[model samples]
Every structure is written in structure tokens, then in C-alpha cells.
Target chain A: MKDRKPLYLMTPALAWLTAFMVIPCLLILALAFFRRGLYGGIEYTFTLENLALVFDPLYAGIFLKSAAIAGLSALIAVIIGYAAAFAIAAAPSRRQPILLFFAVLPFWSNYLVRTYAWIVLLNREGLITGLARWLGYDAEMPRLLYTEGAVVVGLVYNYLPFVILACYAPLSRLNPEIAEASRDLGASSWTTFRRVVLPMTVPGIATGFVFVFVLSIGNFVTPALLGGGQFQMIGNLIYAQFLTANDWPFGAALSMVLIAIMMGLLTLQTFATERASGAKREES
Target chain B: MASLANPRLMLAILAAVFAFLYVPISVLVALSFNDGGLPTAWTGFSTRWYGELLHNRDIMSAAFNTLVVAVVSTVLATILGSLLAIGVEIRRRKGRFLETIIFAPMIIPDIVLAIALLSFFSLLNVTMGLHTVILSHVVFNLAFVCSVVRARLKTFDWSIVEASTDLGASTPVTLVRIVLPVMLPAVIAGALLAFTLSVDEFIIAFFTAGAGRDSITLPMQIFAMIRFGVTPEINALATIVMAVSVIALTLSQRLNRGGLPGQ
Candidate 1:
């Protein structure tokens, strides 16, 4: 009771993170302000040219495109995941835990395996094509793989479990009586959902949307694997800058931008959650 | 109003979403056993790819390296993370800065952390290898472990610790003899989770494991194989990797009902 700063227990782990995670991230931040050397080394001079370049029309276009893809994936994932979560929530309460478990099981698997699963399904000679041909559809099929759509599908597929998990929380906690009361007042089912259930669940939707968007925006694997490197998302751009273009400063700068976008979305998610709880408190 | 609770409609939605989620991975798993080893058609069943996998020296070595990294990192992460969790929970001060430190790794984009670690390691001229990969893995592994342990601590009774201290037991003795035993399931659950994450981590390992094939983990190997295209070996490998994670996560879930970070 007397000791105020008894941090002995946390010191080791915090020190490790500070050294490895915090210091490294800070190094990258500082590196963004420096110049890239002729031999791809980082030079010891400060400059904002790299940060300025992040908004260069060329780079900014990639940012916008990445956002679009990420936004689309997040949208689709939230829709489908919300539906799934709602279905699970409507099930018998005793079965809800197991249902949620099965829904989220796929998320635990390796990320690359999950992405490669899309590759198997969407390849030109893959299962979908085989099924199409078997169905006697003798028309030129649109390319199924290596497209932006494929990248979005990959992103959605990979992150959908997370959305389902997020949405299920609020849906499960929802007091059925509220919906009953809304309907008792002659509110249509859709009207009740739109005005009552949906409003209560906005925080979950916000979290799910932000999670998928933040992950998808900087995703290198899905685009690389499914987009065939043609749709150079911000992720692949960062990859090339560091590994191939040998520009450490630019890569650092690009990641800084990515971090900023992530932080902004996360802040919004936090705000939504806090506001939601605040409103709930007023209701009580 | 009946539509909202319509069992048939709810079942259909669940079926479609689950199919959408599972069908792709299921196909990959099914194809791994195809005797013909062709993406186009399934022949008879065989374990030929798994057998071939055993003989692939690079994959064998990569698996060995992955195991080494996973085990070592999980041990470090569990010990440090459990201690960190206890430390954070026991203290009266609930600092936002400390919470952010614990939370950042779980949400930070993988590539950002990977590149940051790469830059840091190279700046210090640390020769990158499995060692460097282990170092980076602990950064996130400990965070995940901490979060999981901290979740179990939410329901923990603090009065017991004060009581134990009042009975003349030292702080470390009370923690070791009292708190650790109570949260042992969570600690183990967190360790299994950390092991799975370290085993499956790829992007970070790919960057930090510089200048040699010697440091390649299983996921890095799988990524390289995947980029080459659809091959029987990759399907088989993906099946094994998926199975490992699924099994580990299930155990973790059983050990701590609310083990997952968000849950």
C-alpha cells in the first residue's frame, strides 16, 4: 500500500517492448525525415522531402486506390459478417458460445493459407471454372483471378471472421425486450431494426469496419497473391520501396502514413465506443 | 416481427456465410489429399505430398527453425506477459500510456512493425537471422500474451493478494504462491496463443531474417512456395499449418473461455 511505483513485475516486459517495438517504430518515424543514401543506405540528414512525396499525385493515387479497396472489403465483410452474427445471436442461448467458436475458428489459421485458399478457388482452372464448365456454360468467362475483385474477395474472406466476432458481441448482449417493445408499439420489423437494434449495435459495426479497413489498407499478401502485383496497393509499394527500390526513407515515410491512417480510424472507433457507452449510461 | 426470429431464415444465413467462410479452405484441404495432385481434378486419395514434404530438406529445416522460434518465443512471452499482466492489474494506477503499450502490438499493421524492426536491426547492424526474428516475434507475442492474461485478471479478486501480504508473505511469494496458480489456465492459454502466433508469423520473419536461407520459418517458406503458384506441396503444407493453428487455438479456447483478445 505504501509503494506507489512498484513496477518490478512489469519492468522486464515493458523494457523489451520499449527496446524492440517502441524504439524501432520511433526509428522508422525519424527515418522518414532523413534522406536515402546513394547505395540505399539511410543518410544522417533531416529533410521533409520524403513526407512531402507521400502526397505526390502518384503516391496519393495509390493511397486512394488502397483506401477504396480496403473500404470495399470492410463494407462487404461488415454486411455479411453482421448477417452471420445476427443469425448466431438468434440461435438458442445455450448454443451461442459454440456457434461463435465455429464462426471464428477460421481466423486462427495461418493468414497466408487463408489467402491461398482464395487462389485455389479463383484460379482460371480452379474449382469455380470446373463447375462452370460442368454446367455447360459455353461462354467466355471473366478472368476470375489476378483482379481487383479477387484482391477484395481475399481481403474480405480473410477478415470476415473478425467482423463476425465483433458484431456478435453486441448482438448477443442486446436485450430482446427492447425489440419486443418496439414491435409492441407497432413498429415494423425493419423499422425496429433500423431505428432500435441498429443504433444499439453501431459501436460493433464501427469496430468491425475499422479493423478490416486498417488491415486491408496495408495488406501486401492478398494484393501480391491475388492481384498479381499489377494492382500495386500501398502495401506492395512499401514492399518495393524497402526491398527492391532500396529506399529505406521512402518506405519509412510510407509506413508512417499507413500508421497515421490506422491511428485516425482507431481513434474514431474509440470515440464511437465511448459515445455508445455514454448514451447507454444515460438510458439507464 | 416473426421474420427477425425466423429459424429457417436464420439457418440459411448461417449456412451461406459459413459456406463462404469455410468452402475455400475446405477445398484447399481436400485438394491436399488428391492423388493426381492436380488443381483441375481430384483423383484417388493419397498422402504422397506429406511424404514428399518429409523429404524436402528446405521445408524440414524450416519447420525445425519454426519450432525453435515458436517454443523459445512462447516461453519468453508467457513469462514476461503474465508478469506484465499481473503488474498492470495489481497496481492502483491505470495509466493510458501503459495500456497503449500493451494494446499497440495486437492492432499495429504487420508490415509497419516488420519494416520498423528491419530498419532498427539494420541500423544497429545486428546480423539478421533466426535470432533477430525471435527478437521481433517477442515484441508482438508478449503483447498478445499480456492481453489474454489481463482478460482473465478482470474477474480476479484483489483482496486475496492484500490478505496474503498481511499474513507476512513477501510480494513475490504471494504472487508466485497465490496469484500465479489462480491464473495458471490463462497463462497457459496465453502461451499457446503466443506459440501459434510466433509459428505463423511471416512478414516480420521474412524481413528480419536477412541474408540467408538459414533463417526461413515455415510461413516464409510457404509464402515463397505460394508465390510460385498452386502446387501439391503447398496445399499439403497449408493443410498442416492450418491444422496446427486450429488445434492450438481450440486448446487455448478450452483453457480460458474468453481467451481471444476481443472476446
Candidate 2:
């Protein structure tokens, strides 16, 4: 017992991850280089055609659309989430925890349910339409469900809590005196906020933005439910390719691209954070 | 102050944001209790829909399968993750590669992982069912559980275990009696979190479920039902599912203290 290493204890869990996650992920990489079989399985011969097809105009259009939706969702979520976080940070100190807790409480609930809630709200015979009809406005409103806008709203709803949590960390930790100091030095309120407040919270903003974008761009459920399958995002395309289309090789290639984009953004975020904080680590 | 000087503005932002966050959920919850069970009007309130859940065989079986997955996965994850957390903290080396392997499960897109596992299992010619879903779930669940337990271990008193060993206790005994007690809260919190995640999980389970009715979990059932369209029954089902997760998470949060699950 005395001679036993603690590293031995890590073996089982780490081994499980390596087998299930690591191996599977590597398999996906291997899968991308292979050709699709006539019977819709992987062929033994290797080729770069699948990877190249990811940039084919049709798929690239979906990627561009996904990026646009993801970007818009992230942007909107950040603005709203930042304001909510700021409001939470400004409340009486005793109530801040409660506000923050409730702010994120919905996030902990089922993601599907949250998405379904929007379905109920936006459906033709749904709550909003019903309310509108009851309020004497029945002139054939444009259908809301199954649109790109609905997809964006659902994406924003699902990820807003994460942004709130992300932004709240920096906002809560911000020192009050800095703002007052800038104000005392004759900086206007807006100027003080723009110069003194927002810059310091860049890491949080970056984190929130990256998270929303990454999750949204690859999201299948929200678009499937809210977009009513009217539009295809990268996620739906991947789903179709793998499950419906039986093009596993192509799906794997698309995933490789998705993973590349995710890793690149994360690496950039890490660099940004380090650059932002590198100046303050004089002693270290 | 890290606050808005304009109280009116703060109030307005908080009100609007909270409304935006909560209104849809509130509508769903309200409809679940509607006696008329239509979005058109609030006829009255009743628990009939809740009662109706008992008679639905598909949902009942799906719920049972979900419970099996969540319970089994949580137990395995808790044991393996606690050990992993303890082992990592006790070791001197901070291997970045090891860190990435552990954290990748947490950060990977659920769809990518789902497809990856689907491909892996198919390539291996393994039978896909509830068992495979359990296996796939442990990949992420253990990572989350490891993270939670590891956070507690950061402030852990290592000397007690050393003292226990010096006082003639074996390593296993010291861990069981001393370390486990200190880590019990985090371990439980981790288990609760894992349970909710597994219960609510859909995509991976859907892929691994292998086109079978028996292995269908709650979320997969919900997905199928949702694709067909929304009904009052779904609203009731959604309400119950949401409540279960919210309660589990709230309890987990209480046990962990101050730190939310993801953070």
C-alpha cells in the first residue's frame, strides 16, 4: 500500500475516456479520409474528396448561413446577457445571488423543453397568435414558426444564461473605484463605461461570444424544432448526411471542419485572455 | 460601484431580461395545468394531464429507461470520477495532455460526439442499445463529476490522510473513512448533476438506441413526440421533465455551494 502510486487510481477513468471518447474521436478523423461505400458504409481506400466536399458550394452555403445565425445569436445574447448581469450586479448585495441563481435556473432545465416552449409560443394556433386574435388583430400575420428568425430566437434563449453567467463574473469582480476615478478625472458617464468598464470585461465577452457561437453553429435540435426544417444549418446537414443520407464519410469530414473551427476560436480566446492579463503578472 | 447609477435603468433591464428568460417556460407550465388543454384559452386548472401520464405506456417505458441510464451512469461516474479527481490532485505533474483528454468530453459538441460514438460502435460491430448509451454517457458524465470533485479537492486537507496512514490505516481504509467523508458532498452533487444530464440527454441516446422501442429513453421519446408536433400531453410531459431537472440541479447547487455546475 505504501509503495502504491496515486496515478494507478486515475487509470480506470482515464482509460474509459480514452477508449470511448479518444478512440471514437480519432475514428472520426480516420473516417473522413475514407470514401463512402456503394452500400453507404466506409470503404477501405483513402481519399481527400470528403474533406474537400465540405467546401463545396452547397455545403459552404449552409456553413455561411450557420455562421451568420450563430454570430447573430451570440451578439444578441451578449448584449442582453451583459445588461442582465449588470443589473444583477447593481442590485442590493444581499439579493444578487438570488437574481443570479434564478437567471441561470432556467438553463439547468431541459434544453428540449426550453426549445419546445418557443414552439408553443410561435405556432399558428399557439399562444401569441391566440393572444393577437383575442386583441382584435386578425389580418393574417406572417407565420413565425419554421423561420430562420425563430431559430435565432431559440438559440439565443438556450444560450443566454451561459452568457449571463460568463459576463457576470467580470462585472461582479470589477472594482467600483476605477469608474469613479475616471469620472473624477472628468470622463463622462458613457466615456467612463466605454473606456474603463467594457475593456476590462473583454475576456468574459469573448468567452460568452465564443460559447454561444460554437454551440449555436452546430446545433441540430433548435433549428429542427424552431426552424421547422425549413432551413438547414451545419448541424442538420451533418445529421442528414450521417443518418438519412447514409454518408458517414462526408459527415465525419464536416465534423472535422466543425472541430477545427471550435479549436481555432478557443485557441484565439486563450491567446486573447493571456494578452489581456499578461501585463498584470509583473511579480510572477 | 459595479452597478448602474440609474436605478430605473437597472430595474428595466432586469425586468425585461427576466421576462425574456422566463415567459416561454411560464407559458408551457401554465398550459400543463389547463383543464381545456388548449393554448386558445385558459378554461380552468386541473391535474388530469399529470394523471394521464400514468396511462401512457410509451412514455412510461421511456421514463423507466431514462431512470436506468441516469442511475447506472451516475453511480459509475461518481466512483470513477472521485478516484480520478483524488488521483490527479495527489500527483505532482500537471500534464496538459491529460487535462485536455479529461476536459474534451465537457467541451465537445454533443452532435459530434454522438456521431463519433455512433461511428465507433458501428465500426467495432458492437450491439447498440441501452448498454452502449450507458457507455457513451459515462464518457461525459465522469468528466463533469471529476471536475466537481476536483474543485473540492483543491481545498482538501491532505494531512489527515497522511496521519491516518501513519496511524496504521491502509490506503483504502484511509480513503474510505477519511477522504470519502470530506468529499461526500461534492460526490453527491456530482452524481445529482450527472443524473440530470443523463436523464435529459437525447442525441447520443437516440443514435445509440438502435431503432428499438425498448431502449428508447425519455429525451428520445420527447424528440420523437416533438417532431410529430406539440400537444397538451407534451406540455405536461415537458413540465414534469423540466421540474425533475430543475429540482435535481437546485439540490446539486446547494450541496456544491456557490459554484454553479458548469462554472
Candidate 3:
């Protein structure tokens, strides 16, 4: 095996990725500086106009709104998912895998189908309304579908499994003795959890938050389907720029911005995780 | 403290979550068989929707296109991914840059990759179709397959390969007779996973399928039909698509000795 130098075997996959992914991404970075053609083709002429356009109030407003919605969804998902993961980890050890599987199964299904399920649940004549009417309240049903709440619900539901998986890590690995020792020292369960458990799980929550945030912020599907064209996220804007508006360079620029936002969040998340892990090690 | 995690309450919540996830799917499945299409009312059961799907030319063509893409992409990815996994593990150093590049396809927002591919294809004047979509799908699919195979390979014993080589087996001969046999299950599992992913993938396909009705894959068709508003046929199609993914994943899991937890 030593004589063979297996690096040659790695070349095909590396070459394929570089040609398609790395090079293309770099191409988009370069393309962002070029001028948009009058007829949607890119002109090689250099300009900062595309990046400047992203900062313009109209698109900037969408970016802020997207961040708000993504943040809300991530926050809510982590709360529910952390509680659930805590419950599962606190269960018998033998059962954790099965519980986690069920928790994550919805995530592996078609993304469109999962989002569509919420449409069935939230539409005017949908399940929630049907239940409301079934309770004999004949008042006009408020518009629920295509709202900000519905979008949040879709994002939370779609990204919730990842939250569970992320949160489960710290929960399952948590040393019960520390919490017990805290309790023995006269701390109440809530106090122990607040002072100890929560701090321990912060890194997991940060991870789940960043993941859900990054994915949901760049998500086109939920906004397209659940928000129903009334609201536009960065993802939907990018989609429209490419497909509907026929503006490739602009779309490329939006994608670059999206990538930058994701990378920034990810870097922050990594730093948070490293710091937390360091604290954990130091305490140990 | 124990009562806070009440067994009944936990069971109920678990049931509720599963019901929340599964009921709509089950409803879609049932509605596809309903003679009447509305969710509000369920008439007698029938196979009419499935029959209709079978005969629908557009859906059939889309399904065919999806199959072609999935099969070709999965095969290519599995081969590339398996070899890459073996290579990386065997070599095992000084490729952090390559590792990040390979892993980027996995973590990069799908929209970013999708539009990047669209831009890349157009910039190259590459004629886009199922072919271009296949190329794009392979980019990510290979990453997934490599990860899966590499996980299994981490537990692999290298001495046998060394011993085989010492016994004068050629590299190609040793790979075929030794490494391939040991890695067969993982490769198949990886292929199934890749196929499932390729089948369910929408965004990249949406961008790279070019300007033609001919290249419309099932998910793209599903997206369009969905936008045209809910139909029993879509419910039927959704049920089928979900079933394919579930079955593929379940099979892959069983083959993989319990699938990767995060997938």
C-alpha cells in the first residue's frame, strides 16, 4: 500500500469537484464584478454595480427580513428540539437511536413534500381551519396561509430534525454526575439546569442555530411555497433573478452574498463551539 | 424529576410528532386512491390516480428522465466516491484543502450550488438538459457517497491489501479481488443513497435542465404541478416519490448496518 501512492486514486473526485464546484464558485465571484448585459448575458466589463445593487434598500430590506425570519425559525426550532433531545437523551440509553431516527426521518424525505405538508395544514380550507370550524366558531377565518407565521412554521418543521441531532450530542454526552453534584449542593433542578445544563448545551444550540439559520436564510422552497410570492427571501430573489428576471450576473452576486453570510455564520459557530469545548475541557 | 419525563406523556408526544409527520403523507396516499380528489371529502377507494399517472405521458417522460439521471449519476458517483474514499483514507494526510473542497458540495447551500452550476453551464455555452443536471447532481452525490463509503472504510483492515500486494497481485487485480469484495456492501449502500438523493434533488436540476419541457424531471414536474394548485394526481405522485425515497433509504440503512445518523 505504501509503494502504490494512492494519491492518484483521489484525482478523479478532486478534479470533478474543482472543475464543477470550486472553479464555478470562483467564476461567480469574478462574475459579480462584471456588468449585466442588456439582454441577460454577462458583459466582461468591470463594475461594482451588482454588489452595490445588493446593498440598495430594496434588496437590503429583503435580506434583513430573511435574516429575521431565519433567526426566528432557528430560535424556535432549537428550543423545541433541545427540549426533545433532552427528553430523549434522558431516556434509557437503549432507546436513543430509535428515538433519534424517528425524529430525523421527516428530514430525509423530499424537501418539497415536507413543505407541501404545511400548505395542506395551513391553507384556508386546510387542517387548522377545518379544526377551527369544526369547533363551531363560524366567524370568518383569518388568512393563515402565505403569512410570515406560516413561513416560520415551515422553516421550523423542515429544519427541526437537524436541531434535534445537533442538540442531542451535548445532551447525550453530558455528565450526569456534575448535575447531581450540583443538586447535592442544594441547587434546584431548574437552577442546576440553568446554571449547568444550559451552559453545556450552548455550543450545540449555537450549531443548530447556525445550521438552521444558514439553510433557512438561503432557502427558496419554503418562501416560494409557504410565503406564496407575497414575501421574498434572498433565495427567492436569487431564483427570480436567474429564472424570472433573466439577470445572471445579479443572481450570481446574490449567491455570492448568500455564501458570504453563510460562511460568516459558520465561522462564528465554529469559534463558539471551540470556545465552549475548551471550557468543557478546562472544567474537566 | 422522573415524573417530568412521564412515559405516557413522552409516548403521546412521540406519537403526536410521528402523526404530524405521517398523517399528511398517509392522507395523500389515501386521497390518491379516493375517487373524489378533494381533501375535504373522501369517496370510495380506487386505483384510478396511479393508473392515470402510468398513462400520463408527461409524468412518464419525467419519471424516465429522473431514472436515467439517478442511475447514471449514482453509478458514476459511487465509483468515484468509493475510490476517493479509499484513496483519502489510505493516504491520510496533507489534503485539508482538498477535504474542504470535497465537503463544500455537501454543506454549501443548495441554491448557491444550483445557481453556480447554472451560471457555470451558461458561461461555458454548455447545452443543458438531463445531461447537465446529471453532471451537477454528480458533484454533490459523489461527496455523499464518498463520506458514506469512507465511514465504513475507517473500520477496514489494511493488512489484507498489503498481504495481497506482497503475494504479487497487481494493483488493479488486488483492487478487484480484495478491496472490491470487502467494500461491496458499502458501495451498494452508497449507490442507493446517491440514487435516493438524485431522485429527490430539485434545485440543481431546476437550474441545469435548460429551456425545454423534455428535460423536466419528476421533482420539477411536481413543483410546477404543485404551483398549479393541489391535485389528487400530485398527491399520488408525492406518495410515490416519498415511497421511493423511504424504501431506498430503508434499504440503504439495512445494508449499511444502520445508516449514518445525520443523513
Candidate 4:
């Protein structure tokens, strides 16, 4: 009877998730296998053409490009974020929370507003140009806004705090004794960090990398607003299929591929985490 | 070890990272007050653009729509999510599938969820409006609220509930008189977080809101204005929106950490 109580309590939320989240996701998956109607609607005929088109050279090129951009952004963010997290963790313990709090505060702000801030900074007559003119470089200002670099900067700026938080978790939790023992055994600080500290924190690095990569790859807004209309990432392709071209099947297929990539990364992250913890267990 | 690295280097790195995080935002806020409405040059400081925002009907309607969506969705999400959290924590046997379902809304790309909900509603022949936005927001909002509440529940003492039950209190009575009061702070924190998220969320609201001016949210309005170009009015609007989110999230974080030792 007591066990049944939990089931009863869970029913409402489960029902809600099933109706809204689960069923809708399943609907999209099913939609991917159907044909597009002549008039911008879905037809009830089964077809694999939509899935096949996702692997076509043109679309596949976009996928590879998106991955490259996402990977680059993740790599840069992880480097910067890891350094910030390490610095925070090394700070006086009393100051760590306060520092971490402010670090992540910007992340809580409106995403669009944060992204739009870049526009104000990078636009033709924006702050960067104003500064350039102030320095007496009176030639035509270089185009900074609506470029690939702008998109990469926007992704890094938006996702950096998350990476910092992820990295900080393992860094702060690290046992100091192991590093001390490494030093006592004549190992240099760099060697200690590489052999002991970095090994234990692989999970954090993996988590941050996977997170930034996943979100960046699937991002539409950053590319749309910052990369301009010409830069076609997978997200923009999906957006075009749904809202512009009215090709729902193709859009669904693209999203499925996106989901596949996300699942793969996330599974790898979980595996990395488990392995790291297993290594820790062996150490203790 | 600490002596090996220069303290100046650490401080410099910290300063540089903070500058990278904050400089653009500070520039936008400062320009919102610029008398010259263009970013080309700052003539002086003025609040004229803020006054202009007050007179814009499109922005006004979008703001109103956003409030409605945020408030309604936050309430529904708080109720559903708190219950779900309590239930899950009590069961203590959550399967991998269940955990994935709960976590999915947090990590799923907003565009995918937006389109999925858009497709779902349209196929059901349901009219899209602010109501659809509210419904869709609840899906993600509830997940966030659940996670927050569940985190709080981790440190909760189950013995109190047993004590209340032993004294002949009914389930509802025990829940209301015992559990709810203990969980109130976290619940409020979760609600605030949900409210802030719903207010700022754009893509999902955009796709699910259908084609209508009546349902346009503040973020959507901001997006449209941004696409055209940056304006001082957008700066004012952005400042206000960012302030609200920062304030709400700060309050939420404080409340979540309240009564915890050394926080």
C-alpha cells in the first residue's frame, strides 16, 4: 500500500510528460518517415526519402560545417572556462562561492539580450568602430558583425558560464592530499596536475565539452542573428525547412540526426563520468 | 604551490574573464542612456529612449503577453513540478527512462521542442496563441522546477513526515501542515526560476505562438527589432529585461541556499 502511494503520486506528472513531451517527440519521429503534401503539409504515406536526403551531399556538408564550428567554440570555451574554474577553486575557500556566483550571473540573463549585446559591439557604427576611429585609424571600418567569428564569440559568451560551473564541480571536490603526495614524491606541480588533478577532472571536462558542443551544434538563433542569413548551420537548415520551405519531413529528419548526435555525445559523457569515478574508487 | 604562481597573474586572468563576460552588456546599458541614440558616438546621457519605449504599442503588447505567459505557466509548473519531485524522491527507485524524461526538457534544444510542439498543436487543429505558448512553456518550466525542488528535497528529513503520520494526520494534512511548509522556500525559488525562464524564452514561444501580433512576446519583439538594427529603445528594453531576470535569479539562488550553513 505504501509503495502504491508513490505510483499514485507520480501518475499526474507522468501523464503530463507522456502527453506533452513524450508523445510530441514520438510524433516528430513518425513525421520524419512521411511524405510532404503538395501544399506545405504532411501526407500520411510512409517514405524514407526524407531520411535519405539528410545524408545527401549538400545537407551533409552543412552538418559537417556545423560540427566544425561547434567543436571550435567548445574547444575555446573549455580552455577559457577551465582556467577560470581552476582560478576560482584555487582562491581562498571563503571567496569561492561569491566568485562562482558572479561568474554565472550573466548566464541567467535573457539569451537574446546577451546575444544582441554583441551586435551593439560589433555593428558597423558600433563601439568597435568608434574605438577604431578614436585611435585615428580613419579608413573604412572592417566588417565585424554578421560574420562567422561573431557567431563563434556569441556561442562562447553564452555557454562559458555553464562550462565553468561544470569544471568547477570536480575541481573544488578534488582531494588535495593526492597532489601533496605527488609533490612530496618529487613530482613538479605541472606533473601533479597532469597526472593526478587532470585525470580526476576528466568527467568535468567531458561534461562541459559535450554540453557546449551539443547546444552550439543545434543552435539557430546565434547563427541567425550573428552569422547573418548566408551562414547555413544545421539549425538554420532545420528552421528553413519548417518555416520557409514548409518541408516538415525534411526538418523532422534533420532534427532526428541532431538528436542522434546529442544522444551519442551524452552517452559518451556518461561513460567518461563513470570511468573517472571508477578510477577514484580504485584510488581510495 | 600557491607561491609558485604570481598572484598578479591570477588576478589578471580573473579580470580579463570578467571583462569579456561583462563589457558588451555594460556598453549596451550605457548606450541606452546616451542622448545620441546611435552607437556611432555618445553625445550625452538621457532617458529619452526609455520614454520612447513607453510609447511603442508593439513592445507594450508583447510585454503584456510575456507577463501573462510567465505568470500562468509558473503557477502551473510549480504545482506540477513540486508534486513530481516529492513523488520521485519518495519512490527512490527512479528508472533510467524516467530520469531521462525528467531531464530531457532542460537539455533538449529549444528549436527542436518548439517545432515539435508547433507540429503537435497544428496537427491537432488547435489554434496557436498565447495559450499554446503557456502550455508549451509549462513542459520545460515544470522540469526546471522539479529539479530545483528535488535538490532541496535531498537534504529533507523524512522522519518529520512519519511523525506527523503517527499522530493521526491524514496524507493531505501532513502534506500541507508538514511537507509544504518545509519545502516552501525551495518551491518559491523554483517558481521564480520558472517565471524568469518563461519571460526570457523566445524560440519556443515564437514557433508555438503561431502567426499573430497578439501573441508576440517581448523576446520576439526584441528579436524582430534586433534583426532590423540596434536602436536605443531596444537598449532600454533589453536593460529592463536583463535586470528583471538577474534580480529574479539572484533571489532564487539566495532562497535556495537560505538556512544552509556558511552560504
Residue clash pairs of candidate 1: none
Q: Give the Cα lDDT of each candidate.
A: 0.91, 0.91, 0.86, 0.91
Model 4, position B253: C-alpha lDDT score? 87
Provide candidate 3's TM-score on chain A.
0.97
| Tens digit of per-residue lDDT, candidate 1, span B1-263 | 23357789899998999899889999999999999999887798999999999999999999999999999999999999998998898887789999999998888889999999988988898999999999999989999899988888888888988899899998788888888877888999999999999999989998899979898999999998888889898999999999999999999988987433423
Error of 2 at A132 (Å): 1.7
Q: iRMS value of model 2?
A: 1.6
Ranked by TM-score from best down, the candidates are 2, 4, 1, 3
lDDT of 3 by residue, B1-263 (tens): 23224577666656666665567666667777889877677788887888889988999999999999999999899988998988888874647786797788999989888888888888789999999999999999999999988888787778988899999999889888887777777888899999999999999999999989999999998888877666778888888898889888988888889533333
Per residue, candidate 4 scores C-alpha lDDT tens digits across A79-180 of 999888888888888998999998999999999999999999999888998899999999998789998999999999999999999999999898777778
Report the Cα lDDT for candidate 4: 0.91
Give me the candidate number with maximum DockQ. Answer: 2
In the range A96-205, model 3's lDDT, one tens digit per residue, is: 89989988887778989877777767777776788888899799999988999999988998888899899989988887887888888998877888898889889899
The estimated TM-scores of all candidates read 0.96, 0.97, 0.95, 0.97
- What is the CAPRI rating of model 3's predicted complex? medium
lDDT of 2 by residue, B145-225 (tens): 999999998987688778998899988899898888888889999999999999999888988778777999999999889
